[model samples]
Target: MAFEPRQTSVGGNIRQAGERLFAIVEGALEEEREQLALWVPVAMGMGIVAWFLLPNRLEWLGFCCFSLAMAAGGMLLPAGGRVRQAIVLGGILACVGCVLVWGKAMAWGTPPLPRAAFMEVTGEVRSVSAIPAQQMSRMLVRPIDAPALPRQIRVNIAQKDVPEGLGEGAIVRFRARLMPPAPPSLPGGYDFARRAYFQGIGATGRALKPVKVLRPSTSAPPLRARLFAHITGRVEGPGAGIAAALATGDQGAIAEEDAEAMRRSGLAHLLSISGLHVTALIGAVIFLLMRVMALSRRAALDWPLMLIAAAGGALAGIGYTLLTGAEVPTVRSCVAALLVLGGLALGRDAITLRLVAAGAVVVLIFWPEALVGPSFQMSFAAVIALVALSEHPRFRAFAAARDEHWLRRVGRSLGAMLLTGFAVELVLAPIALLHFHKAGMLGAFANLLAIPLTTFVVMPLEAMALLLDIGGLGAPFWWLTARSLDLLLVIAHGVSASPWAVMMTPTLPTGVFAAAILGGLWCLLWRSWWRWAGLIPIAAGVAVMSMASPPDILVTSDGRHVAVRASTGGMALLRAGAGDYVRDMMAESAGFDGEMSALADLPEARCSDDLCAVRLDVNGRAWRLLLTRSDMLIDKAALQDDCASADIVVSDRRLPPWCRPRWLKADRRLLWRTGGLAIDLNQGRISGTKIASDAHPWIVPAVRNRKARSGNQL
Candidate 1:
């Protein structure tokens, strides 16, 4: 009874504190409920990103059951229980996102391909694009009789492999070896198979016989495809391919060296029809329409001038999206543009963070799988940073310096451009490093020289050329467009040659990368001073990334290539295959930024026609690794030598157990099942991640034994 007074004092103190906190929050939100509602969609997007990162896809029945339960619970809640109601509403929205993703996955399911010696593929050509870099043409075909396959199959036909008169809607038949989409080149890497599943491509193959056209349809090809064909045909210069890429979002024809140069120089984003391009196009439309409206002020006065501009801008964005086949990035940008334009029409805040969040919500609701793409991540990161910077007092002051002297206006404009570039880099660099292990070091300067040219010159000229082509006066405009592209290419090449053009770093841990993203969002979206707290997580991410280490060894998914860290600091390859795709992936995965051929020769390696033996010294201790073909493993003398000397034996076949007790054998069986291996010599461990851990229904199980793979198409 004596302690009752203390308990009463504690309860009274807690009650008073809670009341004060509630009053403060209520005051803050009194007039901002509508603005705060914008975050609901952003939260929904967060849930979608989380859903895609799940190890296994959600089952439809389970999702539906849970969603129904959540909805019923929310509906049953009393009106006075605001906190409980908010919790239930958030749960329902998250569950809705998960269910929508599951539905999309179900819609993408297709019948499996038959395992036969020769697949007689007969299909109508849906589209054809050339990869001049690889001397190959990709044909998307709609199979007629291949019931065991998806509706479409992508066939890679080399110049020497097939006859050349392929066009859209032309029926063609060829003999080919159909194989499943290539799996991720490394464990825990991007799943090309999962992407293919969403793209409705069940199989890929190389044409073995000449493509024989059975019939040609009367319908015209897609506008984007026709535009690509026209650009490739009419323009005959180094810049022609880039013009097509810029106009139609098709970069397959660009030279490999040029593409690499653009990537290194940070100009690659311009090559794609991304957000900047869309914004420029919309701005151009608005400016042109406003000029025309100025000539007729009476009509402009009758209608809201800004509404007309917004409507025209929205139309331009939509047209551009359709012209680019509504690619993921374009779709995302278009949604954002439409949202802001719609807000303008409704007389709302069109440039707020809420508008951005609203756009993200729309895109995720329609195409949630895009949450896993690097483009989506980078695009949103840049947008969030730019928007946040624009809201700062200094930036607003700088932007408001338009009434000053002409030279001052020009200086302010230049400063704004510089600040925009720097802010975008600050936000996007971490994402690029986390995914690609490299940041565009010369990106700011490159954008300064490149963006104005592309926006004011190249894109405008391309649009004019399109308009002129309809009037039979396109040749000069096309030439002007090509010249502008050539100048941009010159800038890209020159900047790429700089010593500090690319900053290569090791990969960040997944947790740290996610934390950085959340921190950026929190800083941008929060309205109070507490937003400054986000800086802690951002700093932590930087510290962790600085300390991260690259993998010491990388193995190809097929066991055909293996790279080990050499004493000279570059990766030494076991073999160089006909195609460098897998080898490049391995090099990038291990954070080897130099040319692949720069790998130092192994002086400690002994080589024969069938096998090579090398000594691996990690730290001060030496270990032996043997690389051998399946046939060579049958030789008893060489096998005994390998078993006696090697700490680890690597082969494409299972060998007899004649090794020392300490020796570790990496045989074909393990590699086949796991896809690849990344070893950490410093930690004396290997990453245990397996391909199956992130497997989807589209990925068929890997054959476990030699007998199962005897006649299988891998």
Candidate 2:
């Protein structure tokens, strides 16, 4: 009887504690409901992105339309059912997202090339830009004669193959063999083909002959290109490339080693014209204009000088956007800047969460596909984090101090930069790890030095140099800009060389990244102790990612490159030196050494002229794999040897009939149908998965068309 009473008392206390926790959570949620409600569209946008990343395509376009209609019907209901209205709104927005994404996929998927072949094409050169850090150039040509190709095809030409004086908007003819865009390099790797589809690029090829300029061109190259040329011509060294890259968004002249250093140090963003550069330019222009106007007492008194200054800042942002060719990042930044300026004109908070949400919604609606890209993810993550950080009490208190001295202001500005870097890295780390499988551990420290130098020194000099070049006095500005760039390069190299600089990690599952994003947003949106609940998913995601394992084998799409995990837990190349691109992809994905090791160096992999073999242990089961080429297929001795010894045979030719029922095999036919193959071995059983198959535009045009036609009926 005493034990029963004690147990009852403990159980009652536990129930009371649970009820208190629940009440606190409920109150926090209720308090945050209104603020969280605004992100419905943003959540819908994320849903749309998720739909795109799904492995298998679903016919949900009609269902999405139906849900949207149902949502519209909910709005007509009486206002009493607030909970019902919220549910209806969320489901409807999610449906709208599905519809928009399906529509974008269909729009971008305009019948991939019917076949790959050599062709003679004559087209107008829409634009020409140098391949990054390479002497070659990529020309966007709108083909007039090639009816089977996309409206615009990207043609790559060697510097020598480009005809003299050829420029943008020039009508030209070239003979080239075009192929459809390369498929995903790995299973669920970056989809260049999908990106190409969205970019209106269906075909890519190398020019077989020099481009022949057809007509007498009256117009000059594009304004951006002309500026690039003039700047490169005047600045005569490697730094000239960096100068042009900053001024005009052309990184073609940057050295590959220097670029890698920047990437390793996480300073690559400086090379790209983005939010920081745009804001600096606009702010500088605005400050100068306001000062100039302030000097004219009569004019200042007669006009709304504040409004005039805001308008001028907006205009400067627009001009700089145009100067950079309005790339995606530039356009996004410009939109945000204009939104802030518009808010100022309306006497509202310029950098409120609502303004950021509105800008994000607009960008998502117009460019739903961008959500799949690393740039959009990284860019928005940084912005969202910074905006949230700006709301903290410490920052607010610092900003409210208006009468601060200049020295104090400088100190605060430096402190703010460090905080911004930390916030951005916090948000972008998981995202970068998920997409690129790499992160710069020391990126924050690197950016502390790089950001201020680029912002206050490099960009200013570049801007001044552009202006002075028109008057033949640009040499000094360019010299100074070059010096700053050299210093930045040195810093990047030094930082990248640090022992704890770059962290190459294994691939992270998409679900982990999505969970991390959700947790981050939840914490950012809510202001309560209950917000700590968001950390659960974040911690879970990191735990899962840390446990990720590498694939046992990797085979390229063309069966030209093969890598297998050795018994010692390192990747061993079956072939050396060929398929460098594929090699790099596998190495990075598997979290092996960054460089592809020679077959001879790996003790476990033995190679001959026609064959290479490696042994892999998965779940303590031995898997013997043979990597061979076409010529080895016809050699009965080699085939017999392979069939007898190997558990999995990966070859460039069809397996001989003798080996069909004997061992599992992947050959040219299977590989061609499915872009690439990854095999998993467990407990003496073998199974394989392909990168992708007929769902791709080039693979199943007929099926895609049928699906599109049937989509309207759900």
Candidate 3:
């Protein structure tokens, strides 16, 4: 065929369509400029306010350093050689400067603190994680600072220790030395230090010896402790507290089962008090109150009423945030909502891209660490996606069609919801998976149902509770809502049970996900269609998986212990017992079905179908083998023979410490059954065969040292 000159016609049509699209976007951008300008400064101001309000309050000195750094970073911004590079580089340096300032302030402020050696320190538990409210514990600790060392030591218990009954707000002093957290016992397992780094915990008191709580002139109460206590006390109803949690993201009273349900159902954001909660509150309150006002002729005409309701909603949002301890997510959501709502109240407009950017810059300046958190990314992503997708002029075309049928309106809502979910998840998923290690395959589906429920059902009930409490009849509402919550949980559990609900554990490296998210963001925000480039990071992530060298052992931080999971094989617990959450995390991450297997299974899950046992004889000692759930055992007589024949015998457990497997719990291979006259396998491999001990063994440094803790006094 001749070269198709006919394509010339299509090309013109495509160019025309592109021009029209560009015109539409340019118009919208023009409309948004004013709103953007006003919000930018307001949000920036609030961020500064937060910096002043945030605890670990380092006023002048820290502020000076940050101001200088921001000024320095400002230089790179105008270079304009590369926008993305500038933003990234400046953000990184700013973050580093802030972290340094914060760390220094934490270390140097107040009483002269001393580093505590584990051996020298005698500490007492201040608090531990007995509930979802506080994930970890605080210990009243002292440092084992002697002649050679003079560093302040603080110990944080992995789990919460403060009694739910005693409450965290109480002030107490520990007369003990603090020890830093220890690293994980196994290579490629969880990195405790890294986890703590993210968590902002500096030291741990795992080896602390209990000492009397001193009443000696105590210091000021910790901000978190006071905040936790205040939140716990405010909401007293059964579901009222939980509802308040959803309303305020103050999970001080929410049950763990509910949290699990939310996670399984992909509604975890509901409890986060971030974009989801704030958006729902803003929309629901605005729509309802505005409608109520619009209905009344007098109220409709009265701008005062509209202002009052908007103010009410804003106040409610702020109050809820305070109750939740005003953590980073709530603060961001509140600030964002405040900007939009303030714009509306001022008759200005809505938030614009410039506004979002300015708000982000200011927020980062204050809580620079938040720039690296999911809240910062997801919150901004969701907001920007909503603005871009919802404010399209094409929505005008649906106006005529909506008049024809009610179903059309509902359908449009659903469609909008789906579009929003897709847009935001597309933006947030990469980072979510990278940081969290799992992606909800059907989070969009779950969130579709959940969004309306939260807006319509959850928030309404919580609002009503406050009113009912004033009338002394909150119990009824609480009981009624609790049942409704159960239904939501059932839905969550059911959806979670669906095979497609959640993706299997997948590897998500840091930079790769960051790249993907940035690409998606570029696609979403840029006037260019190149946002489709978001696919690059996703593809990179997928490609990485093919050659992914997953940690040999997988571990999760539960604020208490690191749950060990196996990716390929060769995973074992160093200690005899681990917490339930750790076990569950290990099982889930490794895709094990609660079996003894590590990956897809722990090391010893033979199941009821197989019953095998063995005893190894080495150096005249018979050692029983480690049996997972498998009905495997060693022969008494044969064990004796092997012991006589071999040099060193091995058992999975420390049977009086003599027969202890010299290797870590999961390191040893299955030795053959001592008394096997049974079973045959086609392969040469046997689950019960004696294997050579690994030659180049790994030795993890001991996280705890009894000798080190003892100081000159000891």
Tens-digit per-residue lDDT, 1-714, candidate 2: 654656458778998898787566555556766576657656677568656654445536445655667777777755545544655777677777766777777766554565577988999888888764677899888888666778888889998787876677788988999887766756646667777887888788998776788963567777887788877776656677777888888888888788888888888888888888888987897789889998998978897877888899999999888889776677778888998888887888788666667766777788877777888778777888888888878876765556679999887877777777888887888888877777777888899998889889988888898899789898999888888888888999999888687666655667888899888887777666766888999899878777766667777767777777766676767666666566668877766655666665677767777777776667666677777843743578766876688888888776666764234676765665555655556423322223232353434364344445544432
Question: How badly does each model clash, as a count of residue pairs?
Answer: 0, 1, 45
Candidate 1 lDDT, 250-318, residue by residue in tens: 998788778888998988888888888889989888889888887896967786878899899998899
User: lDDT for each of the candidates?
Assistant: 0.74, 0.74, 0.48
TM-score of 2: 0.89
Model 1: worst 10 consecutive residues (lDDT sum): 704-713
Which runs of model 1 end up more than 4 angstroms from their true locations? Answer: 2-5, 8-35, 57-86, 111-117, 160-165, 296-306, 346-349, 598-600, 629-633, 657-663, 688-695, 702-714
Q: How much is the lDDT of residue 606 in candidate 2?
A: 74
What TM-score against the true fold does each predicted structure earn?
0.89, 0.89, 0.61
Compared with the true structure, the alpha-carbon lDDT of candidate 3 equals: 0.48
| lDDT tens per residue, model 3, 244-318 | 566445465566666666666677777777766766767777777877878889777756775777887898777
Q: Which residues of candidate 2, in runs, are more than 4 Å off?
A: 1-30, 55-58, 62-82, 394-415, 629-633, 661-663, 680-714
